[model samples]
Target chain A: MDRATTETKLINGYQHEFPLVPRPFQRIGESLGMDEDEVLALLRDLQDRGALARIGAVVSPRTIGTSTLAAMTVPPDRLEDVAALVSAFPEVNHNYEREHDINLWFVVAAPSENDVATVLHNIERRTGLEVIGLPMLDSYHIDLGFRLPCG
Target chain B: MNRIAPSPAIDDLDRRIVKATQSGLPLVPRPYHALAETLGVTPEQIMDRMRRLLAKGIIRRIGAVPNHYRLGYTANGMSVWDVDDAAVAETGAAMGQLDFVSHCYHRPRQLPIWPYNLFAMVHGRSREEVEAKVKKIAALLGDREDGHDILYSTRILKKTGLRLVD
Candidate 1:
């Protein structure tokens, strides 16, 4: 199979529900009509090409720390500095500037709610922008895995 | 601040397993053995703990994470909706069921400037594609959705998490 075909297979078939078996590669290869070696090679190549992010457990947030979605609206001139400052925080993961007046959005995870409060407060104090902490009230959908459309 | 429920069951060894597998597991014949050796535990012990982790819902799935940007679904949209608080779960679940929405969450609806309570991540080949998918979510939400906005990522600074595990 070509690289494109392999890529599609790996993305769609394995993105979610990776076999929990010890010999997962062998099982995946068997399903794909390839050997365990071929499966491993394909996966490694995909990683090298930056198509596959990782083959690992997607840990649920809040297991070890508390996290909340936060946003800050900055003046156009201060966007860069504010974004940089927010991104600098180790707790702020998935930082992005989206198309809206309330532009910057990110998730901050810390060991406790107190730490989260401190982080948000620090960001507010540092950036001079009110950090709106919108913690999750409920989870309608938890898993973030999306399948690549099959050819 | 939302009070986080303590998960005291996750002990030191569990932390080690999460640290080991967060990046990924091995791709060899005896992947569990490799992890066990690294963590100074028996293969069976690792396997048993991993199984418990899966059962306990600590691990979403043992899987491959794909980069949608590289996969040609270039347009990524963070679609947020202000739905009636009481009906959020039903509406959010419906939106989550949509194939294009990678994640759907019932976040708080901050007053004044921020009013969106439901967040769904929609992705497509182009901006238009993502917008179309968002519309489908809106339609599914119907009258329950008060207002909605799609925030296409201007810049993605970071997308992975390590703080919680480490």
Candidate 2:
């Protein structure tokens, strides 16, 4: 696809969504004055071009139960082994090695605070690395949505 | 491919609106009106501010949060890729476009052992599905020899909004 076509499709995909109904994509197509297949095709093309991610639900961690941000300082040599060990669990949502001494940071979510504690304890025991738990004490604002251009 | 620019920052009132709407807004037909009431502002004002926020990129999106496990999306993984410094952002933006990928970003790579710089979150109904997606991503990036790890979440401790103090 050419630059103009790619940009147009990207903007449309980002701005348009299927209405909440059976065959919602058809409704979206109606609004865009395009066929349902065409809308679906554009969505697939946008996904292929890396202009949009998955169209799925984003859930709240607190409402579900509990979740926390945890970190550890793994030795350079043992980083991979320790990361693999930590990644073995299913509760970790996302993990990264920040540019800090306390490098390895990961988020854990569970059905309850107690469950999170259990997971943390398991990681400590299994990895033999001290786990520092930073459970969110307060929440200010959390929204992942962002519009494209600033006007 | 040209890089996507960083989003613009939030203004004061925009911050206030966001600070109010962070924890899931009240589920109602007139949710925006309710929010306006809480802020002692008109519904129109709230709507306008939100429109501006969206345009300015202060909030990436406003949508529903599905219970993944309840929906049978039980197996999820965070696949971090060790892309070169020059390609991290481009690769990340590309990865973020995947339908199954819930979240993606670029982070500094740690030395010695930790080298992965790109992170992508993939969700699926089963472990096999998640693994398959990761494998496809690895191939797409042409980083067959790159180091990566799939960290499955074991527990959820605390999930909430980031407080922006003005």
Clashing pairs in 1: none
Name the top lDDT candidate.
Answer: 1
**Deviating ranges (above 4 Å) for candidate 1:** B1-8, B27-29, B162-166
| Candidate 2 Cα lDDT to native | 0.59
In model 1, the Cα lDDT at residue B119 comes to 86
Query: Per-residue lDDT of B1-166 in model 1, one digit per residue for the tens?
Result: 1222455478889878887888777767778889989989998888788788877777767788877777777788889888888887788778877777777888876788788888888888999998888888877777898898888887787787544623
The list of candidate 2 runs beyond 4 A from truth reads A1-70, A73-151, B1-9, B161-166
Mind giving the per-residue lDDT tens digits that candidate 1 earns over A101-148? 888889998878889999999999987789899987766666757776
Candidate 2: deviation at residue A96, Å? 12
Per-candidate local distance difference test: 0.80, 0.59
* Best candidate (score: DockQ): 1
lDDT of 1: 0.80
TM-score on alpha carbons, each prediction = 0.92, 0.54
lDDT by residue (A46-139, candidate 2, tens digit) is: 4555444443223333433467777898787887778777766767756665445566777777756788899999999988888877554322
lDDT of 2 by residue, B58-158 (tens): 44454433335443565757677778777665676677766667667555554654576666778776879999999888888885336777776554333
